[model samples]
Target: MHRITGSHQVQFLDALHRDHVEVEDRVRTNKAMGLARLPSKSWRVNKGWVLTCNLAADLDAWLRLLTLHDDQELARAEPETMRLRIYHLPARLACHARRRLVRIERTWPWAQAFTTSWARLTALPALT
Candidate 1:
């Protein structure tokens, strides 16, 4: 869309191309998440739906980066893979000794991955 020059020419071009690719990837992801449909006839209602969809996508992205970044397969996984493996896996939350704990089937294939990711997420510095 614009010219690139000076000391930052290659850097700018690389960034621009990467951003374009990322946008395309996000568009596909959004479609997979049902963002292609307008939930209501009214523009106002549709606007709200769009906001909700975008928020859900953003939250999914954060969860993937924060929770599952350690595993190579998971780190590159799309939202659908994440949903099946991590989000929809059943777990029970309980409070014990004033601390909340999540209990899951010990035999679950990804239980360890889930717990490790959870611990890493909790240990991260709070975002400002």
Candidate 2:
């Protein structure tokens, strides 16, 4: 790395450090979503694993942006918290009027956030 010089060096260094921290945060979150270790020795398998991790990260970001806008706690939640509270909730599937429905216990602590996110997602127009 080239050494930055001149009177602006401190400002440049601060900006660079900020960017570095952001990158590290992304990697930490990715690890939290199962990217901490590769599960296979094969190159192709590792590649697919990495892609899956990336997709999970993207979906988390979009979920926060599109559905969790009003909830500050959930909007800023880490990957593991989201996995536990939203994705891994106890639920049952049922069908009614030709529509499949997931039924979660009303008393679950995160139930409201989960249902709100579900409603927001369903209300969006489907991609053709």
Most accurate candidate by lDDT: 2
Top candidate on TM-score is 2
Off by over 4 Å in 1: 1-18, 95-99
- Among all windows of 10 consecutive residues in model 2, the one with the lowest summed lDDT is 1-10
Write model 2 residue lDDT over 34-61, tens digit each, in one string.
7988999999999999999989888888
Q: Provide the overall lDDT of each model, using Cα atoms, as 2-decimal numbers.
A: 0.82, 0.90
The number of clashing residue pairs in each candidate reads 0, 0
Which residue pairs does candidate 2 place in steric collision? none
Candidate 2 wrongly placed segments (more than 4 Å):
1-14
Q: After superposition, how far is residue 63 of candidate 1 from its true place, in Å?
A: 2.2
Residue 115 error, candidate 1, Å: 0.9
Encode model 1's per-residue lDDT on 6-123: one tens digit a residue: 5367877788899999999988778766689988899999888888888888877887788777789887788788777787878888999999988898878878878888888889
Per-model TM-score versus the true fold:
0.75, 0.84
Worst 10 residues of 1 by lDDT: 1-10
